[model samples]
Target chain A: MLIPMAKLQIAGRREELSAVLEGIYRLQGMQLVDVARDPALDVDAAGLNDANSLTQARLELLVARLDALLALVGSDDRGDSRLHGDPDPVSGAVDLADVEAELDRISILVQEAAQHLDSLTDELAVLPRYLHPLEQLARLVPELAALPEYELQKLGLDTAALVLNTSDDTLVDTLRRELTEVFGVRFDLTSARVGTDAIGCLLVFSHSDSARLHALLGQEHVRHLPLPSAYSGQSLFGALAGMRTRLDALPRELADAHQVLEELIGPHVEAWHVTLAGARAELEQLAAAAGAGVTDRAFAVVGWVPRPHVARFHEALAALSMGPLAIEELPHDERAHSTPVLMKERRVARPFGLLTRFLDNPRAASLDPTGLMALFLPLMFGVMVGDVVYGTALLLVGLWARRKFGRISPGIADLCSVLVFGAIWAIIFGFLFGEALGNLGKNLFGDFSLWFYRGDANALQPLLLFALAIGAAHVLLGVVLGMWQSWRDRAHRHLLDRVGTFAFLCGMLGLAGFAAGALPPGFMSPAIALTVVGLVLVMSLHGTLGLIMAPLELLGAIGNILSYLRLAAVGLASVYLAIVANELATVGPLWLGIIVATFFHVLNLALAGFSPMIQALRLHYVEFFSKFFIGGGQAFIPFGKSHS
Target chain B: MDIGIGLIAIGAALAVGISALATGLAQARIGAAAMGAIAEKPELAGRAILLVAIPETLVILGFAVAAMAILLLPA
Candidate 1:
């Protein structure tokens, strides 16, 4: 049930304001509305500031611990289970203090290792300089053996390897061409810009292998001249790439270290747990101190306590000298806008609370209307569907779904129950009409057949008669319910209005029956006159114009009766469909017969099942519910912990 | 006899077609409104779907009638 709420306006010192709001928060289920303040008058509470800072620090620690845990879990399919399982809450709280200490230790160790690796790589980059002279000998021996003495002497002069820096492009090009032609050895130019306007190269045989080149490049002069570092850009990238294996293992290593520290400080976890317990106790005491007294403010703290808790909550508040807090009980009305069945009793007595509420409310007396609607809704549904086999199948399916799914929505469950009931009625009616599947006149009894017609006869008159009878009963029930609600509400005139309408409808029905010769002439003639007079009197009771509109009202009532014929039509259609399915199954070839029968029967069943369910609800909501129901109740909004 | 059967078949087809067209148009109108509401508050999807499907039952009932007419008539 929707609970009516009042807006509360509070004015107090800021500290006192916060204290009151805190007390309100402690109230189990009271929803506070528009809690505003005048900033100038409100003093910021010292305790609130302390609490805020403590909460912020706690949150930061929690985030850091979470990040560390995520890193340990890794980014892979293996980590999925951790996401699904509940974390050990005890372990979570214990780990926070250790995490900071462990992080500090690991950070220092990682920094030292990183620096050592950097120095080693730098040393390796300059190693080539020391081995250069040996490399020069290796290159010289291979080349000199192939040369003549005079050529060797000339080469020897060039071999002295002058390290003069050359920026002169012409000189460098001339030297390169001369070397290529005369010695068949390439000039290997190793250049360095020592300062502005200085460039240098060491010439060597192009045929010299890498081993000889490495040795020659390792010479004292090359080392002294500051040759380009071997581990410069390329080796630095390689070093970084290799470090990934180490970096990736960091989490596991830290985890192992953390494990060792955890074992060492295992007793400390207990000590801290004790400390936390003490702090919580202190906080609670402080909260109690703050809530010790109540000021004479216009507004009082309101909240919801389960019906059972109300007494205890009231006692507790009174103990604190807060006096009595007004408690309003809200009913759990599941329907979106239906009136709540407020029980005066504390204990809920029924399995279906809403159903029980209906039973209790005298205004809802229309719900148990003489079993006519109960009998008619299903009867109409069965007639509309019209197949015993299909109806039986629907009953079984609905029963199974109800049993298996337990309680779904009351609306859907109620509808299914109605369909199942209809199916039962259809089976009985199908037998009576000698219609199986859609054979309207087909005799299952063969020699015992009572009807001779083979197919399609106008059953409209009987069906229409049945609908009209049912419609009269339905409308009468509605009037009765309207009168009952009015009587319950003590609206005496409304009760008279309902009774007058009911009498008028009965009279009209009698007159029609007499005209059709279904009733005695004297009996129906008097009823017709009496009905007209009653309607006139009832209409005139409210005003004069009602007497003039009585004829139009009677016509409208007739139109309403005609609407019930849809029930018969839909029922007949169901039977007709079932018969067609059976006929198709019987006539077709063996395989075709099976296929056609199955498809047609299944199709018919689906159609029959859904059609009545909807139409049945429509009749109830529009025709029946409209008579007395005026739903617009507000839903109960309680202040409590949301499980979601 | 063939012509009689053909006429029944045509009638059944017409019934099915008209029913389906009616359902389609009604559903489109109701469904568009329901979808707009769903966009505004997605929590209403379940109830909206049920409400939108209510009128479509008439088409299904029509289909059942047409199927019966087709199969029951002599071929």
Candidate 2:
């Protein structure tokens, strides 16, 4: 719900201005509006001296550098963990010059340690690429050179080692075939898995065919590594020996670098975070003075404070009393457009609040759509998916994600909560639709339709009507709400507009009922009369332009109702995809069938999870929201709040 | 009868396919402009998605038509 706000106008001695502003900052409730904007207040706007300007620049520079430095280390609230039952040593305002000196000192050490850690990690990751292929070469190269009895080199047969860095078995096979074409069956090529991706190959071919072999390798663009030169002029065996030695030593270097970082940063990270936060808070408090109107003897600050916080605001000022100060609750200026919005929502509605905010903040005077959205969004999503297996899987996944990421990001937690609710609704709708993994329930239990099967073609007429009914209900509710808001705001034109839409929808539904022979013949005249009256009212409101506008508005409303057909369309799509999955499963061998079925079901499930969500959201954003939602209210940003 | 069934199938396919094509075309233009707007002001991301989603009603209406042709027509 949108919280009621009071416009607070504070006036005080110029000497007590800082104390009053600091007191308000501690309250953490009021969103300051610049008092200087009022031209009647003969006062300076910024009231910045050279000293304040210098302080602003210095604080900003320090805070920015600290932010970058802390972000690089991926630090988050580290100080709190270390301060268990202990007083915060870095509490209160920090001296800027001392912080600047300490920050610069720690910055150099952190940079060096971080650089060392990065290089060591890169070396560790790259070493395995070379190590695997070289091991294969070590086994082949020594045997060829040391076989004194064979004299293979004298016989014009030579061995050269190359490491191929490819994971494609087909490419390796192609290279083998090409080599055979060049050197015939006389050439021996032995290749082994060198690393996760690289291959180590030893080619033994006649010197006569060596040129063609090189050409073949070049033509294939075989991206092979030349023999490792751990030590130059070393034999292949000796080069592998040097690499083996370095591989053994690499881990030790990596460990040493890690230890260096731990030693450099372990004691200081928490302190640095605390100091950075304190400095930033102080900077915000100082900068908030720019919003005040300063005269020769007094100053003034005006802002909106939530109604519940008015008492707290009074208490904060009572504690900071130095001289005679006045804080008055100004009568709400209906004409003044500076009222910032603060929404207070229940925990159950918080996730929907996030979604509502995603579009834009609802006007303070307008309704908070969180409650309605919470009721409808997930329920509509469920109707689209409506599968027991998919619902259960999504529920489990959503629960796991919420547990895993809830503390780190509230936005992700809100999304997970939405998914969890949608999944629950999906489960309920699944049973109503009599679907469990498409028709798998029927196949297993021999006809499982508690209600009508959505996949059946015969359900199409009733399904479309059911969807249309839901659309009509939702649109009617929006019209009712719009009418209520119009009446509350005393917007007579808007009230008439919504009343016309309501009458038109009722008349249209009555006509549909009458045509289907569900209503008496006498009802036809009333329905036609209502529709014409609605049209006349709608048209009369627009005067001369109503001729064009009335028909357009009527068509737009009908189109909105038609849009709900997507609920049926999306549901049917999911059911058919699952049916296809089941059909494909029966086509192959048992193992292949299971694989194919699982693949298709997973694809269907993935689409069901994301596609239905988008369609459902589109229904809200495009169809429902267009009826009444007017979002452009400014979010309340309290003085001294950390936007970061 | 076979030729009639084939024609019905083609019509149903066209109902969905043509509208989907139109939706894709509309979304492509909207999405490109939305991306440019988002690049300039990241806060417009949510509104951009809504704009991109609006044209999908074309495909939805087409789907409804296709569903009618396939199911009601045969009956």
Candidate 3:
């Protein structure tokens, strides 16, 4: 059910506006309506967005900065938000400077550490490529070991490790020959094959002779192998030894860096979120203040409050002693927007409210379909997936999931709750339909059905008829609801249209029954009479347009009813698949058959979960909802709710 | 099977097969656009599934027609 709303005006002196707004914020009862556009306001309204621009800008900037800081900090390590206190927007503005100080501190420390950790990770990954070739070169050439012996720079010698790409086997020798030509025995080279297409060499030379040594190495088919950024500009033996030491220490350093980040960030994450939410809430309150109406002496905050909570809403704000304060209910201006709907339902129906809102919230003063959805969606799902074994499994899983993860995610909890209801219905229908892993019920206990076997070929016509009957009843219910809605809204033509549709559907079914010999011949005249009367009522309402669209709609409505055949078809598919699984089990070796049967049954169950649920929902959304639902209504968002 | 029965079987098979093909085509188009729309606005997900499922009614009707043909025609 949709709760009624009272359009309210809370007016007080300018000085009392902040305190009064704070009171309203704490109440979290009113959805603010902009005073300027509200025709319901008797006074000449003034916009407040321009009022106190500086403070609003400051708060907005604070929120942005806090959001940035929070982003830099990861989600709370504990994965629970309960550890944090709620934001208190009305407390004071003294913490802005403290927040700024914290932001600056986090920014500098995090920037340096983040850059360091990033480079370390990249270098760690890149370092292995260098090691493979260097190791290969060292394994092939034993003389290379002597190069690491030097504290090369202290000894005034430098080593450049090179991996040269070349098809020629003599490329290393040519490089050695070329280097000797350039420096004339000032350099010693130890070269070996790196891989099939390359040579790896350690060239030890005078540090002073490095410029000329590189000029020859830069020649085609021969270039110095690039080193990681950290190890650049160092001797190969020194870089290698440094890299080896770094390699050993890298994991520990990476862990230390992460640990440092966690220590700096983890504890304050929830606090930051709370602060961020508080700053945003304050900003929203300020914006609401800006939107509020003002005179030379009085400030008026116009909003909608739930009718049942109107007294409590006033009592929540009674603490504020604003001079000559008055709170009054204003008449709703039907055309001017700002009335939002809040759905009120029982605790059991609360979970299904999610599905209702997933499409759109019910329009203000319109019917809430949550109760209908809760009643029908699961029942239809049960009808489609009637199986005791599958239903039991789903029941256990749904219950476990609802209990375990419901606290973590409300959406998942809602889905799990819905699944539990659906599973219960499935079990009830399973016994009624006589299904347990398909025909296994029959094999176990001959004709164990409380009703009839759904798997029998003889059941197809009856199942189709049953499904159509369900569809017709559901469609008729939707039409009736639509008629009531139109009547309440005083949409006279829409009411008549729904009435005509309802009468026509009822009459058409009667005629269909007569044609199929389910009704006596004497019933034909009245059935035809009722249908003609309905068609005339429908046609008279639309004038020129009704002639074509009315009859087409008749076909469409018939098609809509026929659409429920999927319930039978899909159910039959599931049952036959199970039967095949059982048959395959009996035909093969016992162990192999058991395995195959288990595999197929599991596959069938998986398909059942998605297929039947989707089909049942489609029957409602398309066939049923089309008859009544008017979507695109604005959801009620209270002033104090997190703007995020 | 008699020739008349074979032809009736072929007609029934066509009734189901052709509509299934049409439904596949319609759903393919609907599903692709639905996925794209859902990627941009995830709140459209339920409606997207609804749109994707809407076309499958064609195949279901076809199944019904085939069932009628097999169960009622010869009788």
Q: Highest lDDT: give the candidate number.
A: 3
> Candidate 2 DockQ category?
medium
Question: What is the C-alpha RMSD, rounded to one decimal, of candidate 1?
Answer: 17.7
Q: Of the candidates numbered 1 and 2, which has the greater lDDT value?
A: 2
**Which tens-of-lDDT digit does each residue in A349-448 have in candidate 2?**
8888888888888877787888888999999999888888889998998999999999888999999999999999999888888888899887887666
> Between candidates 2 and 3, which one is better according to TM-score?
3
Evaluated on CA atoms against the true complex, candidate 3 attains a DockQ of 0.60
For residues A542-569, what per-residue lDDT tens digits would candidate 1 score against the true structure? 6867756755665555555555656765
DockQ of candidate 2 compared with the true complex: 0.55
For residues A1-644, what per-residue lDDT tens digits would candidate 3 score against the true structure? Answer: 88888888888888777777777777788888887666656665554445457767777887777665555545532454535444465555436778778878887887787788788788789788887786665554455456555544567877677876765767767766777667888887777777888767777788898887777667544677877777788766556777788889899988888777767777777777677667776777777777788888888888888899999888767755545778998877432235788888888888889887876776777878888889998998888889999899889989999899999889999999998998899899889889999999889977767877898768877888888899889988989999988888888999998998888888899998998889999988888987888888888898999899888887788889999888888888889999999999999799999999999999998888888877887888889888888776777778876532
lDDT of 2 by residue, B1-75 (tens): 778878888899999999999999999999999999999999888799899998888988898888878874665
lDDT (Cα, 0-100) at A74 in candidate 1: 37
Clashes of each: 22, 2, 2
Q: Give model 3 RMSD, 1 decimal.
A: 5.1
